[model samples]
Target: MTAALASENLASADAAIHLGNVSKVFGKEGADGSYRAVDRLNLDVARGQMLAILGKTGCGKSTIFNMIAGLTEPTSGTVRVSGKNPFSDFDAFRGKMAIVFQSDRLLPWRTAIQNVQLGLEMLDAPPADRKDTARQWLIKLGLGGHEDDFPHALSGGMRQRVSIARAFATNADILLCDEPFSALDESTAGKLRAEFVRLVKENGKTAVFITHSISEALEIGDRIVVLKRPAMIAYDVSFNTDTSAEERTLIRGRIGEVLAA
Candidate 1:
């Protein structure tokens, strides 16, 4: 078999997240008023892989994210996480999947550590255990002394650090990030991106990060999938830390060409 075909089969057999012939429509199918956000999109992400999905605005990136998060049901075909329907078995994934959004989304009234403990609270973890886990995550994210500060008292980067701490505190196996660092200044975003990639690798988490920036995707993803309008995969490539800079530049140029098309 072709190497690409063999790899595809391996992904299908052991994917942590799978979308098979998945399509999502906002209104009735085959109707004039309806809008199809995804068109028979099939994707497979293996365990512990970091997949960056690059797309233009209104290309249904968020729609695909929602479907994977179990917040939206597909119009046809199947969406599976660890071999189960995330939408139908939403409760089963409560502590198994965590999301980090563009905004920090921290509670105003809660202190940094408390906010980090939010997910653990849902799991009914003991208060002491929750506090310890939250504190450790905060420390790891460089928020060591700021754990007592409220959201309003922190800077944007610091607040997003707390958000990252919260997501990791749950120890979820799968992390879905929707441009989590997009709102920060370039310097801060760059720092956080490096830290995010490190944490994901260290924790052995499967991540699907959606981004509009090709540079960010290149920096964060081991495998990058660029999408066109209607959420179709236009280009897919995989690279690693061992990949040479020249190859990366070529990949970037190819991605730019695809996006421009």
Candidate 2:
């Protein structure tokens, strides 16, 4: 592997999410119709780390996301979450991981609190516990009074907040987000991003946020992994809140160059 790939595959024994030499091919491999979306990609997300994966559309971002989410298996290599294979051990992850999709994905008939309780319901949590957990998350996400409102009655931003509250209500240790805030207006998205980062930190959750937006990645990730076609890592960098603005600007420029190439 190249030095960049080596860095991309940095060893982390305590990694919350690990993908080693993972490749995903749709259709028959080496056949005419086969498509390799991910090619020997390697990544390690340490516990409590918020990783932003940036790439253009059709760069296999969703393929990688599905693999990590245990929705799809890789054609080769291994995908492990908390030291277990995510694909083979899907059921073992129940209540251990949660996802926030691009769309709010709330059921129109369900109230905000009811939507938030969905995950808890899947976990078979007690009725009282589910209600309490859902209510707490809604309040934390600034939807206290809106909890009883149905999805159609809420604004776009409020619906997304309910989705986020749902994800956290499960008390999952890992979060997989696919441009969850991308649909909202910039101001709303920015606020949600800040709230997301804060909640992830405060809850000590490891998150992999997939986005095509460089600005979103820069704002949310302590570690940013920029991928090229076939989902190979092109650049890997880490920065924190204490990072200098000048340095961040330089990193942003570098990422732009990589993507432009």
Candidate 3:
């Protein structure tokens, strides 16, 4: 095997995610009823690489995530994390991965810091330690002052920041995000994206992010894997650049061509 493949296997044995020829079909049987949301998808994400999956709506990008997250199983083939099947070892697998859904699923009654502490609580960390850790992450995400505020009291962007902080605080090796910045204003989204990219890189965490925004994909991903209609990988492009106005424009043009084609 090549070095990359070998490394992928090792990471899979440790904390990686692998999907082999995975397919998800919805609808009942017997009469033109199968809807293939994901078809023969194959992916190997290493221990610390930030990978992006980009596609239009109904293209099965989120379906792929659902399978990996163990929220849903594939109709065929396999999905594994850290050498363990998510379905068979759901609790163990969940410890190795954290997900931030598009919606900020924060508890309405919980304070921001308490919401961030929830993951640690699930892990059974001591309350003091968990609260301290949660506070640090909230501060990291610029939510220190609002830590006592409830979810409803915060703005949408602030709530999303708390959600992101909570996910990172889990200290899971793999982070899965589904259109996390979609609801934020452009400027706030841009800043959050940059900060998130920095955090992932600094922590050496593996990530599979689903986003419709081409610019967001290019900005955060080490590799952008585009899912065309019917759920096949249409383009897999590597991006290596510091975020800049010129780079953004150039990447936008390239991604436009790929989507247009």
In model 2, what is the error at residue 197, expressed in angstroms? 0.5
Mind giving the per-residue lDDT tens digits that candidate 1 earns over 1-261?
999989866777789999989999999888889999999999999999999999999999999999999999999988989888999999999899999999999999999999999999998999999999999999999999998999999999999999999999999999999999999999999999999999999999999999999999999999999999899999999998899999999999999999999
Query: What's the lDDT for all of these models?
Result: 0.95, 0.94, 0.87
Pairs in steric clash, model 1: none
Q: What ranking of all candidate models by TM-score puts the best one first?
A: 1, 2, 3
Name the top TM-score candidate.
1
lDDT (Cα, tens digit) per residue for candidate 2, span 45-104 = 999999999999999999999999999999999899998888888999999999999999
1-261 per-residue lDDT for model 3 (tens digits): 999989766655654788878878897533496788888987878777899999888888888888888889888898998777887678986447899989899999899999999999999999999999999999999997898999999999999999999999989888999999899999999999999999999998999999998878887898888888778888776656555778667767877787777
Task: List ranges where model 2 is wrong by over 4 Å.
Answer: 1-12
lDDT of 1: 0.95
TM-scores for every predicted model:
0.96, 0.95, 0.90
Instruction: Locate the minimum summed-lDDT window of 10 residues in model 3.
Output: 7-16
Candidate that scores best on lDDT: 1
TM-score quality measure for candidate 3: 0.90
